[model samples]
Target chain A: MAFFEAKNITKFFGGLAAVNGVNFRVEQGQTYGLIGPNGSGKTTIFNLINGYFPLTTGEIYFGGRKISGLKTYRICQEGIGRTFQVVKPLKRMTVLDNVVASAFLRTRSKREAVRLAEETIAFCGLTAHKDKLAKSLPIASRKRLEITRALATKPKLLLLDETAAGLNPSEVDEAIRLIRKINESGITIIIVEHIMKVIMTISDRILAINHGMVIAEGTPAEVASNHEVVAAYLGEDYDAQS
Target chain B: MKQYSGAILLLAVMLVFPLAVQDAYYQHLMILVLLWVAIGSGWNLISGYAGQVLFGAAAFFGVGAYTAALLSHKLGISAWWGLPLGAVITFALALPFGWVCFRLRGPYFALATLALNEIFRHIATIWESLTEGMVGILVMQTFVSKVPYYYIALGIAVASVLTVEIVVRSRWGYYFVSIREDQDAAESLGIDTLRYKSVALCLSSCMIGLAGALYTNYMGFIDPRVVFSLHDVSIAAILVGIIGGVGTVSGPAVGAFIMVAVMEIFRSGGFGFLGKLSSATGSPFVATLTKYISEAHVLSFGLLVIFVILYLPNGVVGDWPILKKKLLFWRRQATV
Candidate 1:
């Protein structure tokens, strides 16, 4: 059985299908990539799976338990943590406070939460700016904080929404390495990113969606050469080495 | 270190107030100060930190007061028992109101809560058989001293400040702050913004309700007019919170202290300044000037609110660090 599966997941906004009958699965100890053009419903899929929005139709199974309509916080408590497409740090709070807040959901004691937050902050390379408010951080650091905040929830299956969108090439490389480290730490990761290089580099398997439907699914090499995947990329050759 | 010192100093002052002020009138004034501080701080919890402006504070306060009064007068239950009972009832009542208002944000929530205050006041007045109507309930205490009442009021105020501090530090507190910053962002992070909002409103109502119980016991009276005027307690709390700084923990306390002290001073002898000028000059218009004291307070409150929002958007306490930096900069400039 897959560790996380969304079977026949459908979401609509006033008769317009944002995500139309999508079925996908991620196994434990796997790294998957969700690549789609703008408006292809990648973030919407993330939203539906995490309970951010109610599904028009479908069931989501996490660790083999159906959890489609449960409250978002409860889903996080159940170890299905997620980051946002747009980084949403608690703008007024310090970096330490931002992480500590999410840590509270996992641990009851403030002391334990603080210790965990401190560790996560150092791990994310935000130790130097720990005392600064989240809004004061640069965009890349803000995105890192968002990831750390989600990780503090101790999720079994972590969904990262465009975590490498705004990073430079070197930063993208670092993020890819960090994401691999996260998965290596025993947390399965499904990353949705538009950066083709980072996506191909980090993903063991790639699922490409277009117009609210999956166009192709295969290994990075196969998906790179697949005619339909190339057509979805508007005929630009995807250099597998890039 | 500095924050702790300020807090300790304030606590010491409160502890010594009863002993320092022997006059019954002044002691009564001090009690009112403590009472308003609790109510304002409670209002800050929802409006300041959570960014949900509620105008139903008077309604919760009135319910608590009437609950305590009814329990004491009708069933002979002690005022102490009624305090927690009132808080629970108000918190329960807050749930439905929260459910309705949770769907409304910002100004709409404020208007809905203001409407609730009027609705509750009317219900209290019309429910004559139970609430004693507009005639109100009076409790001639079994004890003679007002010192016990003083201590209880002070204790509740301190507890309110501590509770707000703790909740702001907790995980739920972060959810509240996130909701305040951006609801959509909070939801995207898998935080249930509505549930956190409802929890904030419920907790805020409970604290305000407890303040109501204290007020009724201390004043020995319960009336819809006195207990349920949103313009009296609700507006005062919002204004104090704004003037002190909205979301900061100590903002409401500082705002409440300054507002009450100024109003009390004006009420006691500042109006008499015009009276003295009238007697000395035999001017009819001079006597008319003192009548404007209350109106002047209202005007001052309005002006202060505008100034704070426009210039000191963080409230006085939130701006302290900036002010200190600027002062240090100016001092270095002068020395050079």
Candidate 2:
């Protein structure tokens, strides 16, 4: 059995199917990349997996146990942590406190949570901004804070939604390095990213989708070369010559 | 230890205040201030820290006051027992209310609480046999002197403030602030936002309920209009929280004092100075002005709220640095 599997998951907002018959699986210790255009249901799939929205039809399994119907927090407790596409920092709290809040999920002790949070902060190279309020941090730091918060939860599978969306090129490279470090710690990662370079470099397997349906699956080279994936990105007009 | 020295000194002053001022009128005002301390702290916990604005604190307040009044009137027991019993009942009330109302966010949740306040007021008024309706319930005073009431109110106020201090420093405090900041992020991080929100509501309800029971014991009377009043009890509680500081632990204490002092000053026409000035001057204009000042207490209170929101925004404790800088600007200028 796969480490994490979404079996025919579908979601409907009234007549519109936000996610229609989507299926994907992530093996243990693999970085799975999901790429698509805006409103292509990438974030919706994350929401469905975390139980933020109820699935219309399908099942999600984590470590061979069904997890689709569980509550969002319960899904997190099951070792699946996630970050938002739009960074959601606890604005009034300091960066350390923001991570400490997430660390509370693993341990009830405040001291322990602080210690864990400090480690995560140091690991993510946010030590300098640790005392600064989350709202006061720049967008790059906020994105890193988002990942740092999720990392502190000690998840086996981390779902990162657009962590590189608003980052500069150097900042994006730093994020890629941080993600690589997290994956090196034997944690599985499923990333939804717009930057093709980051996704191509980091993803062990890539799933390409369009209009809520899977267009291609299985690798940077394979998906990048696929005709449908090309059409999805550049539109249907595909000629050999420029 | 150094951080708590200020709090410890303040507590010492509060302990000696009633003894230092034996005047019954002054003691009564202090009692009101302390009662507000509890109510404001309770409001701060859920509304400020947890970020769930409770527009109907009067619902729990009225329930607590009636619990005491009814216990004394119908059950033939000391109204003092209402303190513990009222807290329990208010906890029971808050649990289900939070479960239902917490589903709604922001203004919608606030509106639901407002509806709850109105519902309780109607229940108290319509249930004449039980609550004595608008005629009100009058409980006999347990003590002729206000000293005991002063100490009791002080204890409750201190406990309420301490409760906020301890909780905000703990894991629960982090959870509450996270929920206030972003419910989705908190939930994504595995914090059950609903359960934590309910926890904050129940704790706050119990604190406010205790104050209500104390109010019944001290004031010796409670009508639906007085205890469950939207303008008086409910709005007064919000004003205390806001005027002090929304989420700061010490904000409510500072806010409660200012609110009670402002209301009393306006209601008593600057503690009778206007009345005295009018009589001394024997001028028609002064007399009319005095009367207007006394009658316009609520209006002045509204103006004070607007002023605080516009200038302080964060309440006294939260905006202390700004206040300190502005107040000491003259000293800095002189040094320069």
Candidate 3:
């Protein structure tokens, strides 16, 4: 049975449908990649699934329990943790504190939360920058801080939104490796990314969307060969093997 | 070790301030400083930490003062019970406003709070039968001297500062700061931003209400205009927080001291130098200054605000850490 499922998920802002009639499922501990063009609604789908926005019409199930329309914090308590595309770190707080804030949901004790936050910071290679304000970190490290913050919640299902957006090639490679390590730690992940190379390398299965509708869904190689996926990527001439 | 010792020394100095300044007038000024320090710090809890920036704090303060006055005069009750009752009512009154205002951002929310304060003032004024309208209520005041009031004010000040310190260092404080920094980010991190904000406002309103009760009993009066005046409730409290430090624990305390001292200096005829300047121009500039300055300290407060926001954005206490760091570096260079 699927650990999480979204059936006929539809979201409309005013009259325009931002995410139209989408269905997807993730098995326990599996890694899935969501790929789409600029307005393909990948982020919207993530928002709907994470309970950040209410679905105009549809249902979301987590751990075999219906979670649609639940408050965002309640959904987080149910073990669905997410990172934002824009990376909203607490500007006035230290990087360690940003992570510690997330860690508070798991444990109310300050000492325990600090310990977990420190461990998670080290895991994300952010120990050196722990005392620095979150706003002062470089982009890559800020992204990593966001990841560590989400990891601190100890969620069963993690949603990462464009985590590798502004990274250099080597940084993107490192992000992919860290993501796999997260999965190996018994957490399921659904990644929405535009970096094709990272997507193809790290994704066990791919779900592609265009104009708020699913265009293709399959294994990395299979989805790469699909005609709609090829057209969405600008042309068939673009190398998918990369 | 040095920082710890410095904190200890400061505490010692604070304990001696009342005793060293034996003049009744000087004691009165210190009492006012302690009062503002408590009320301003409480205001900072929701406005500074949660980023709500409420301008309706005076409304709660007035509500608490009136409630205590009415209970004591009309109902013949002690302030100890009246204080908590007044706080409960104010906290309840805050919920609907907080619920509606939380949805608004920046200027809109500020305007909402300001409007609410006006509405509260109007209600207190027109409800003359109960509130005594502008005539105000007065208690028997069997005690004559202002000395007892000073200690009472000081005790409340210490309590308020300690409460703020605890709330800020706790998990609730972290949640509030997170909400201030980024509301959407805080929500995603599993913080119920709306609930946290409401809770903070409740706690903040109660503290102000307690201060209000204390004020009414000390003055032995509760006039609508005096109780609901935004000058002391909003402007003074806000100026204290901003000038001292908006979010830091010591910011509001330091701000209260500076604001009280400056206002007292101006009020005590130190601006006589302006009289000499007026003799040359014959514009009655000194007269104009004395008249308006005596009426309301708003203009001077406004200028101070502009100066602080422009040059001292981080506030007084917020700069301590950075200044200490700079001083340490200079000392090292000198030794070398």
Candidate 4:
């Protein structure tokens, strides 16, 4: 059985199917990539998995437990953690406090929560800025803080939405390396990204969708070469011939 | 230890204030300040830390006040029992209210609390048999001297501040601030936003309710208009939080002191100093000016709130560094 599974998931926004009959599965320790053009429901799938909003009609199984109808925080407590597409830092809190807040999910002790937050902050290389308010961090550090907060929740599965969206090349590379490290630590990651290099290099398997329907799913190389995925997302002007 | 020295010193001064000053009038003013400390701390918890502005603190305050008054009027018990009972009842009231209204965020939630204040007032006014209607309920004052009441107010104030300090330092404190900063983010990270908000609201309600009970026991009378006045109780609570510093632990204490002093100053026309000048000079102009100032307390209070928002938006405690710098600059100029 897959570690995480979405079965025939469908969502309707007043007669429009934002996500329709989409199905995907992730192995226990794999990093999965989701890619599509704008409004292709990439983030919608992430939302559905995180239970941000109720699934109009679907079943989401994490560790074989149905989580589709659960509350967002309950879903997180069930070991699925997620980041927003637009960074949602606790703006008034110090970075350390932001992570400490997340760490409280697992432990009630302030000392333990702070200890976990400090470890996560160090792991994410945000120790230098831990004392600074979250709003003061630069964009790259803010994105890192997002991941750092999610990591501190100690999730079995992490959903990252556009983690490398606005970073420069070097920062993108750093994000990719951080993601690899996260996956190596035995956490399954489902990443949504528009940046081809970061997604192509990190994702062990890739799923391509368009108009809320799965266009292709295979190894990264296979999905990259699929004709329909090429036409719908990668653009036909660039040849699959190469 | 070093950080708490200032708080410790302030507390020591509060402990000695009523003892040092024999005048009943000044002690009354100090009691009002202490009462505001509780109310303002309650407001700060829900609105400042949890980021849910409560515009109707008088709902809880009035309920608490009535609880004490009704206990004496109907049950023939000591009104002092109202303190604990009022806290429990207010907690109960806030639980369901928060569950329903927390669905609405920001200004909408504030409007719902305002509606609650009005509802409570209307109920108290209409229910003549139970509440004595607009006639108001009167409780016998527990003590003839003001010192006992002063100490009780001080105890409530201390408890309120300590409650905030402990909650803000706990893991729950972080959760509250996280919810305030960003609700969705807090939820995404496994913080139960609604439950935590309910916790904050319930706590705030309990604190305000305690203050109300104290008010009834001390003041000996409470009309719906007096306890539930939107301007006097609700807005004053907000003013205390805002003028003190919204999320800071000790902000409410400072704000309560300033607000009570300002209100008294205007209400008394500079603590009767203007009246003295008017009578001494036998000047109609001075007498008229004093009367106008006394009557325009609310107007002047509103103007002060505007000034605070403009210049010290974070309140005195939150903007202390900026305030200290400005004061130091002035001091330096004076020396030069």
Error of 3 at B211 (Å): 1.1
Q: What docking class should model 4 receive? A: high
TM-score-superior candidate, 1 or 3: 3
* Candidate scoring better on DockQ of 3 and 4: 4
**Mind listing the fnat for each candidate?**
0.37, 0.94, 0.80, 0.98
| Inter-residue clash pairs, candidate 1 | B245-B315
Clashing pairs in 4: none
The lDDT for every candidate, in the order shown, is 0.84, 0.94, 0.85, 0.95
lDDT of 1 by residue, B239-289 (tens): 778878888898888888778877865554363576677789988776667
| Residue B253 accuracy (lDDT) in model 1 | 84
What TM-score number comes out for model 3?
0.92
Cα lDDT of model 3 by residue, B1-336, tens digit = 884586568667767776787777888788888888888888899889988887877888898888888887789987556577987988888888788888887778878888888998999889888877888888755357767777777778878888888998889999999999998888888899989999888888888888888788777877877878888677677888899989988788899998988787666545455555566677876778766665565567778889888767888787767657878999999999
TM-score of chain A of each: 0.95, 0.98, 0.96, 0.97
Runs off by more than 4 Å, candidate 1: A235-242, B1-3, B76-81, B141-146, B182-199, B265-271, B281-288, B322-336
Tens-digit lDDT string for candidate 2 (B220-254): 99999999999988999999999999999999899
